[model samples]
Target: MDRDEAEIVALLRESVRQQRMWLMVVVGGAVVAGVAAVVLLPGARLGAPLALAGVGVFLGVLITAPQRKLLAQLGLSRERAIELLSRADIAGRTPEQLRERQAQRRTMWRVVTAVTTVIAVIAIGYVVSQAGNRVDDNVPGSGPTALFGWALFASAVAGITAIVGFVQLSTFASLDRAMSAEGDEIAS
Candidate 1:
């Protein structure tokens, strides 16, 4: 195969691998958060910031490595990837069409973000409103305050991941199909 097609194949492989990694991050983060909520279950005031910062940092690490790999494999930086894919997309021919396609692709994630926002608002509200429940140290999960705080935390992590992953999935996950070149095309 030609260099370009070979590079595309490498990109396809990397994309699949990175998608799986993010999927694992989502599922695994859920499990970890569930356990932490049950075990430590920090109070509302404490959990909110910790959860936000902790999850944010975790996802940052999860996202950073793949770029290096993508660059190494396809010699394509993130901007180049976006540019190539956008150029190849039919709707990308016009500004309006490109915006429409972007909106269509982002619709699911936008819904997810909205739902998660509502959940977080409600969770933080309930947790804060039950401000006195933190001292119920005798029983586990009895503190609705802490439970909701942890729930919000977990939701925040998963929500951010979903939004980012969905966008990346819509773009990068389709690499093979997007840049596919077969037999004579590759040879040429």
Candidate 2:
């Protein structure tokens, strides 16, 4: 195997590892939420745990979307893909093809990051605006505190999404540049 292929394999392995970690988080969150829901079933605090769980699930879904597309592109299931990666098999991918896909994904993630950054800004702005509002202590989840919590949660999630996407975009951009340089050196 060439250096480029080795790098691609290593990168894919790292990606699969990260995805699995995220999956674990999603499952762990769901389990925690389930327990919380059962314990708080008779109280007004049920919504908070459930809402947090929903956000976890949402983030998991969003993060897995690119993996799903890549799986489709490679015509492999998740388990099979991981297995192939373990064996250092890239499902018949060429460096050029991978670079092209990387470029396309970088472009897509840049757009997604931009959108999420905007959302984070808006959510943070709303949270700040609501910070000074008078609170009704009689309500459980209907007070300013609850509103602030939810808004802060939303903004945090959006900020996380933006950061993740931006990091991926930057990584892909760097890899593409390195690959291009390698190709140029090889050609010369």
Give the number of the best model, judged by lDDT: 2
Q: Kindly list the per-residue Cα lDDT of model 2 for residues 41-150, writing each as its tens digit.
A: 53444456676678867887876877777667556677866676756743577877777777787789989999999989998999888878776778665564444555
In candidate 2 the C-alpha lDDT for residue 45 amounts to 45
Model 1: which ten-residue window has the lowest total lDDT?
Answer: 175-184
Return the TM-score for candidate 2, rounded to 2 decimals: 0.53
Q: Which residue runs of candidate 2 sit more than 4 Å off their true CA positions?
A: 1-92, 136-142, 145-148
RMSD (CA, Å), each prediction: 9.8, 9.8
Q: What's the TM-score of every candidate structure? A: 0.50, 0.53
Q: Model 1, range 1-188, lDDT digits (tens) per residue?
A: 23674456456556757777887878688678767766774553454567766886887667766766766766666776666554455532654555466566656666775676666567667656766555567987675644665666656665576566556556733643444443237659
Runs of candidate 1 with Cα error greater than 4 angstroms are 9-17, 36-63, 91-103, 132-146, 152-188
Q: For each candidate in the order shown, give its overall lDDT on alpha carbons.
A: 0.62, 0.73
Q: Cα lDDT for residue 26, model 2?
A: 72
Clashes of each: 0, 0
Please give the range of 10 consecutive residues that has the lowest summed lDDT in model 2: 1-10
